[model samples]
Target: MKAPLLLHVFPGFAVGGAQVRFAMLANRMGPRWRHAIVSLNGRMECAERLAADVSWERVPFAAEGSLPQRLQRTRALLRTVRPDLLLTSNWGSIEWAMANAAPGGVPHIHMEDGFGPDEARGQKARRVWTRRLVLRRAETVLPSATLLEASRHLWRLPEARTHLIPNGLDLARFAPGGQGGDGLPVIGTVAALRAEKNIGRLLRACALLAGEGLGFRLLIVGEGEERAGLEALAGELGLAGRTRFAGHMPDPAAAYREMDVFALSSDTEQMPFSVMEAMASGLPVASTSVGDVRRMLPPEQERFLAPCDDVALAGALRPLLCDAALRRELGAANRLVAERDLDQDRMFSAHASLIERLLMSRAALAA
Candidate 1:
């Protein structure tokens, strides 16, 4: 018998949370399931990470035309592929959700990571209405408490249909890193330089630290549309030699190793994998208290998470940067959390079971 087919639709198949999660899941599951990926924006940044053995196809989407036209295109694509399971991610893939609303549609699910800059102010009325209309029939998966609650209330999804699957990581790949060379502590962040990520806020905070005669360097990892703007801001803030803009790294394991501290200055996020990765790498994190970040950190480390701003973020990073002993103490605590709760094997098992259960349900319905 043929293996179950899982079609995943993403706004863009970049090295973001949704894409990375799917890649890791596909690699772990091996030949148990076949995969189809659709990227609306047609960018597959993380495609290199997929296992060589996984049978998968990428259905290209040019993202042309108005709302109705896009929906029609998605529906036509669905009719063509006719996969056993349809998986969509975030608002970018909402049109696919709308496509699934048609009569005799394929069994579908949506995995929401978070919103883009468009919803930075609030969930717009059109989006909320669209989500309510299209998501009624699909099972939704949320990896963070923030997303789960948002799905329940904002999208008005029933609790039963929403699964709160907290994000996990490959802990051993990011096992507690040892001390780097005896140089100044490195303040680093692993985030796509995007507007929502607010990398500028981090740069401003770095300036604040510099003003106080604080001695440290900043490492900005990951690439995005906002890279130029961030670089310009860094120059304006007089953080020239103090910051290194490492465009994009396939493997962030080495980056994490060199960092003495991890910082997240995102104005919007649910469960950032970077923070969890930093934790697993035995780095103390000083970040904004967005999403489930406050809950994700150790109790002792909670004070380090402030609102996304120069002063708040600077205040958060101050203690970690100034005190080496504090970094190690909090870093150890963070490592324990990553190992105890966010193991990748545990997450892979959960997804495998979910797929099996969903496939079984589809079979029963077909009968």
Candidate 2:
């Protein structure tokens, strides 16, 4: 039989959590389906992660014009592609969901990877209503319990159609390794230098530690438009000497191994892949408590997580920096948690089952 075509739509396919997860999924499920990806903003940085054997291509999309006009165009593209399944990512690709909203259109699945800066604090009414209206019939996937709860309470999506599938990591690649190169401890974070990631908060927290004569290196990994501003902020805070912005490491497993502790300062997130990778690498984490992070980490690591404020985050990091034994203890616990709960094989199985079920259901309906 012919391989079914699965078309994925993302707002901008930068190397973020959602895109990386999709890449892992596509790579693992190679040749089972022909994959067509559309990045609305024309950025496909994460495309390199896909294996050579994976049958996938980028589908051109014109996101120009108003919402209604874009929807009309997207519908035309959908009809032309005639995919067996349509998968849309986050709010930016909601218009694609609208385009495929008709009863007889392609089978659709929507994945929500938390929010951007705009809706970090709360959800917008318009978006809630739009999701409620457009996604009633489509399967909705959320990678965090926090987001799954929001889908039911805020977006008012039905329980039956919503799936909570946490992001998973390859535990073997991120095995425990020696940390700290020089005398000073290394505190690191892997995140796109974006506003919502709040890398500035991490910088400021480190600055607070530095002001008290604390000695450590801060390594900020990943690249984005916010790099220049964050670099400037690091300089302004007198952290230029201690901070290193390691931009866009294709394989971040090594990045996690380089650090004694992993930091997440994002104002918004939902089961961030960085945190999972860090845990798999057997590193203790110091982070702003956001999304499912509080739940993802071991109970012992909770003291290291603070509210979204810099001072609070700094307070959380202070102890983790000073105590080597505590870091080792928490790191080991984190690795255990990852091995027990965050294995990628389980995630791959869940996704494969979901895809198979959806395809079979669509075939049944057609019959």
Candidate that would win on TM-score:
2
- The global C-alpha lDDT for each of the candidates, from Candidate 1 onward, is 0.87, 0.91
For all predicted structures, in order, the TM-scores are 0.97, 0.98
- Candidate 1 lDDT by residue in tens digits, 74-139: 888877887899999999888888878776788888888888888866789998888888888888
lDDT of 2: 0.91
Candidate 2 local Cα displacement, residue 182, angstroms: 4.8
Cα lDDT tens digits for candidate 2, 147-189: 9998998888989999988889888899999774557889999
Q: Candidate 2's error at 100, in angstroms?
A: 1.0
Pick by lDDT: which candidate is best? 2
Per-residue lDDT value at 134 in model 2: 98
Clashing pairs in 2: none
Give the clash count for model 1: 0
